[model samples]
Target: MSFNWINESTAINLALALVITLISYIVIRRLITAITGRIASWSSRSSHGWTHYLGEIIGRTSRLLILLMAIQMGLYVIDLSPAWESRVSHIWFLVLALQFGLWMDAAVLLWARSALSSKSGHQRSQLTMTMISLMVRTALWAVVLLSVLANLGVDITAFVASLGIGGIAVALAVQNVLSDLFASLSIGIDKPFEQGDFVVFGDIAGSIEYIGLKTTRIRSLSGEQVICSNTQLLQQTIHNYKRMSERRVLFQFDISYRTPTEKVAEVAPLVKQIITSLEKTRFDRAHLLALESNALKFEVVYYVLSSDYNQYMDIQQSINMALLKELEQRQIKFGMPVRSLEFLEDVPVIQRASSDVDESRMVQK
Candidate 1:
């Protein structure tokens, strides 16, 4: 009938602390939920407002952190051994560190999403946002982990030093991979080419199909996929044909030298007329560029207002056919390779003596 198992004061104090802790937890939990809910409601009212970030952070608050706070408050009222207090303190620190890390992770993700969403006409690159979010979360968790270790009386100096050495080793082992990863990041940020862009780099001409972390996949003109390292791609010169607003075309042709000079001069004007008559074309100039041993060369320069290769080819084919027809009507001929050979009318001939005559002459001598 006598509760003598424990000290009366200690028992009473412990019971009171437990009751206070429970009451505090319920009250704090309800308060947090109410406040966060109200903020969320307010944010929802203003769809495009800065209060969304605040509401998000508040909503992400960890229930474990609230419980930890209640426990700490209750424990503060009880008497405990130094060892027990130390252990509890370390546990609290660990929880706090983990909770902070979670908050940071959430914040980073939300910020990334918001930034990407805000991009209207020019959307931010998804790959870049993903990389940024990953790095931020990783760094945050790393710091939190180190802080927890240090709080638990772990010697972080050696651990950090070892980590640095390990990092260096890892870097050296995967330097090329790291280089490509960074290059991919650069590509995302610099926007040298985007997905579905026609690009020529080195000897490869293709349309970018996928831009990845280590390599970019391209659909080659020859109907094959080309996988190129991002580092190598960045190192080479890239010709992004998709960015070209107009294409300049230079073409040359030859006419027979026997063509009348007056008619030969008409070649340039005829070409200009034909080119200017075509839609989406701007004729720059046409001239007799050179008189070679084989033919008279005419150089023509024009611009195609379209960047489409097929459109350019079609325009060029039409112009060529029209010019050919016109030349035929004018009795003009295209130059052809010709060669001539000359022969002497008369020539002296030398013949070798017979073997029998040579043998007889040698016998007589």
Candidate 2:
């Protein structure tokens, strides 16, 4: 058998082209890496979002893509068959499509992050931002996938129609879940309450731990988790204590009925003084509200300037203690539950006639 080797001219050309491609790849890759690093550093220092996003894209672009480009150019130096050339072109198209998709996905993420960060406290909700990011990424990838399919000469019309029908079926199957999901989105937008906010919805009072698509988990006051569907939660009246600017407190206490009318009258002014003496308290009104069967009821109304429950409790306690001390010093008494019983002086007693007759008979015998 006779063996034929490649021609010297072709062999030399291939070797030279390969060596130059390798050297160019190393040099170009390093240059790109260095430039991207510098750009990233500079963009990081700047507050402009677009610049930073551009830098991030540049930094994240795969070096292999650059190498592939170099190799494609190098292949031109060697004469290749039409079939091989067509294969290389397809390869380039695929790589470029994938790289473009990645870049677009990254851009969406970066923009979402920036938008979330720039929002005000009332406008920014973590779940909302996450959902927005997810939707944007999904849409971007869908477009990319369609482009890739088109590039590969795949007819996607029927595929897209089938996807729509499948999506409708899936949505119908998960309608309840979808309802809750939309409710969660509404909560994010309307902001009835956010994570970490203390809220009372229905009979459950708790701090929101997490807001998810279908369910919102709350850490209840009794140290248990309360998981409620977002749809159900939205249906209830939510008392968001976190948003309260001040707490208006109306409390009543009773003094003994034995207290003199003048002293009872003095009680209101005394309570008002006690409440007004405390910081962050606004005394609204104190009055001898009613005369009950057992005691005279006094009503006190005040506002705590702070939303902090602990702070309000502390102020209320201080006022209560001071009021108690004042009443004690003035020889006043607090009302207590009392009961009364009456007794008759005299009552008739009846003896059994059978016992009397038996005694008489026994005596006679």
Candidate 3:
């Protein structure tokens, strides 16, 4: 639309630029408000979900930055010196980069907080979450700063190289600590085990007591606290007993060889019956696996339908107690050592000859 007020140029078109910039700023702000308000309304409809965070991220767009964007748009219609244009371009780059960094920072913080909050009883410490968030933000802002400096015609090659060397030195200085820190993060996110979980890794068996940024404290079976670095803990193959669905059990017992053949044959079926009568047991198979010199060895296999050690013990005890009673009812005797001769007093000494004639002379004959 042609208008008289459109081209009222003065002093590098400051008058027109100001008018345009003000109008643009008003329009953009209104648009942002309307859009963000709608998102907030939608968030309210839900049960305080991620939508609320979405609205906040969008709403956090700085008013000063928005004004600068509007000014950049206004400057598009004006004539300026090469030096001024370069300055304007640099400002634009810096603004956009800062805004991007802010957005990324918000998302990272939200993610870290939610990750910590979501894991119930996982023992992800506040310090861990803070350190993680700080490290990521530091990296992000460093990239943004470098980009801005490069845009302003500063030579960043030397700066980048120096940073690389410095970073290497720092990392090497704290390599062990860093390794444990990152491993702790892995544990928090990947969750091989949680607090109070019974875990066995290598030779260490314990219940997790605390998870820290550098180390994990565990209460061992012998009532001693075992402190292990997160790096060392994660390096080994872990057995999470707390997460075990079921337990496989195999046991062996022997019965006397003198027991009747029928009774020996009945052992397997009798053992199976006893195990089946107990709750939380899945009968597998029972068999007379081997015959010893003095006993018949029977092997029994089954599954405990629980991971609880006490429950398994209770079931085993019941099986053992019932076994002896049932065997007594069937008149079957448990295995015992074979008979052997013993002398109570010394006998008459006899000397053996090395030759046949001498042997006959030494003998009773």
Candidate 4:
């Protein structure tokens, strides 16, 4: 029997294409699974766990691409109108482009992790890697979007002009956010502080808990979390205390003025020896600075051979207690200001004689 375009040929072709599309999907999914499994096996052998991550991203990307292509081919085979077919194709292409960008971004992260493993001492900040990957993906997506627009025969010149005009207002509305984002970028590049570093800016001092796109989270000494804008953090002078291998401890005390100068000199050396003998404390310098209005001033400056704040305070307390006990044992008294007036018998007699002489002079007159 002879067949015409109007009757049955279209339905038969569509059914065949549908079956082929389903078969393609199943085969492609199996291929993706097999490829991912092999990659996981290689990762176990190669000692680079990051490769496993890369494989998973690629596997999913491959499955998506295959599904998209199968759908497009099936639609074309079903004898749809030209306009509808074109629209579907364009949509599929856009989706494919977006997925491709995502896949590329994932690959970038996996590569960065591998690079970090090869090098020793100070890995690249994860925030930095994330920002770079995002920027790269954004640029790629921008290109892909523009390409799709061009394929659809959009007027590129007019679109560029409109974007330029609208961009100014959008920038003004979000300038603060943009500033913070750029500042975050600068921080990632400059690396003034990283996660787990103790930082002090103005009166806000804390250990960095997280570095985000526009803010950084810090855990304060009081155990409160503080979220600060990156723009402000970059603007201030940051004190990174975590980088220091030692901490400096300085303080002053007073001794009695009547204490012998020789004894005062001996006190410094004794204190020095005591501090140096302690664990994780260094004897830097101690001196009898001056005799004050009420008491003699003594200054002690030393280094705690550790960055631990608690240990530093503990060492300082021990030194202070030892010094106080030593002074008491030496019978050196602490100075105190006293105000008093004493009248002696000789002073009274002199005053009486002066009064008598004045009275005799008045009588003679």
Candidate 5:
């Protein structure tokens, strides 16, 4: 290469620019640190949740970004050719755009964490937030790229048109996946069921364990994990037991028909008292429903004021035991199916045979 010697003034400009860039980088970094520290201190005393999130995002400011910005400042001290100036301006735009994208990316992450932290064990909200975060970051980087290209004198309309066509092709290729994705998003918004909710759909009953982009995982009562696509899962009706406020209980029992009518009438009152005496139970009605061939059929209706299956079982057991004890004390017997047969003959077979043998012996004597 041919030697190109710089004059004293030009040399001084280059030296001065380098010095300025170094000092500026150090100063900017220190300023970032100081600002982040200040925000952190303020966040500690603030009850507002956004303050802490803001501090975390600010702390993520990149050192490379700071260096680039410092170099941008130093460019003001340099005298350069027109072509170099134009190219440097483009670089400046690209650097600044990229830094902004980074900051926005950090903000998105912080917001997602904050949101997810508030809703622990809820996969619906977490998956929804993650999807949204991905969309936002994608949009941010797209904007940055498009702006950079336009700043460098590239025709973005044709580029965007091409991208649109490609996007359409890709979307068509993954139609099933996209359908499931949208279904999952709908689940997040409509809230049909959430993670950790016990649900029954068709013949399957299980608790939701995880929700993914395309599929939802469930742990069935039989101890196997069920992975069902979001679209298919949503296509069916789901009964969410977690949302139940109370359980309506209807049961029947029978007493021996030998029980007196007066005693039969007392049973309803006894059942009502026994049910009402238990915790979280609301007695609705108790009546002698019908009289069958073998027993008096009684119907009892009540409600357990809880969604807990175990709690409801416990209350029902207590009521059952109490009612049984009361019945035993009152000497009222439970009804059981019974059958008997009687012959319409005056003399039994064995007695007639014995008399026949006795007459024979007397004749012989």
Candidate 6:
């Protein structure tokens, strides 16, 4: 048996491909470094960190592109026979998919960085960003799949037509998920509640964290993350407390029945003044309500100009303390629970004892 060494055509092709690959790798790597350096130099360290990370991504992508080009060119140089055409097509398809995936990832990362830099007090914009990323990735994957089908010598147009029919059936089967997805879209557009906004819907109360395709995530007051279907959220009544500019407070108190009517008249204006004088609080009205059996019911109505719950509480406390001080100064006393008692001198037992004593006295006389 005679052993055949490397043929002239194969040797030449292999040597040329190796040289080209090495040169392409070196050139692409240097170019990536240069471009990334230029971009990073334009920003401060805080902002440059993302750019640096992006540079590494670019470098890797460039290397991949160079390798792909080298392989594609090397196939022609090596004179690949028609028998291997299907395998070559498959390889190209895979390489194309890989390239698309990498690009999609890079684009998503860039948009994420932009969203992170947005100063909207909350990451509300991230919902839009995420949706866009998902759509883009989906489109990329679809293209890759189509290419793969075509590379495998499948009739892509007919396949797509068949897929459209199947898609209808699938959509019908997953109508609930589709409905929620559309609801998520509505949430993004209508924006009844945004990320970090305190919202109450039905029995749920929480701050929104994530708005996904089918679900919305919330961080509850108990520090737990609550996942809710977007459809359910949309169908329910949503109360967004973040939009509240002012808060209304209605409360009741009690005054002693012994207090004079004139003193009751003085209490309203005094309480109003005390409330209005406090920061961020306005007294709407204070009225002596219906007289109970034991005390006069007083109702106080006020509005706090601030929406912050803590600030509202602070203002309320201040008004409460001022009211207490004013009541003390006016010598006004709060009412306590009381009951009334009546006594009758003509009771049966007393009458009986008195009659018996009188009879005994008369007998002694």
Instruction: Say which candidate scores most in TM-score.
Output: 3
Which candidate, 1 or 3, has the higher lDDT?
A: 1
TM-score of each: 0.79, 0.69, 0.81, 0.65, 0.80, 0.60
| TM-score winner, 1 or 6 | 1
lDDT by residue for model 5 (1-365), tens: 64368778888888888899999999988888898888888889888877777777778778887888788778878988899889888888888788788889999987777677775535448779888899899999999999999999999999999999999999999999999999989988788998899999998999999888899999999999999999999999899999999999999998998888788889999998898888788999998898888988999999999999999889888888887899999889999999989875756787889899999999999
User: Local distance difference test, per candidate?
Assistant: 0.89, 0.85, 0.88, 0.82, 0.88, 0.79
Residue 345 CA displacement from its true place in model 2, Å = 25
Clashing pairs in 1: none
Better of 5 and 6 by lDDT: 5
**Top-down lDDT ranking:** 1, 5, 3, 2, 4, 6
Angstrom error at residue 225, model 3: 1.6
Worst 10 residues of 6 by lDDT: 120-129
Q: Is candidate 1 or candidate 2 better by lDDT?
A: 1
Q: Please give, for residues 288-323, the per-residue lDDT of candidate 1 as tens digits.
A: 999999889999999999899999999999999999
lDDT at 98 for candidate 4? 70
Per-residue error at 128 for model 6, in Å?
Answer: 7.9
Better of 2 and 5 by TM-score: 5
TM match of model 4 to true structure: 0.65
Lowest summed lDDT window (length 10), candidate 5: 115-124
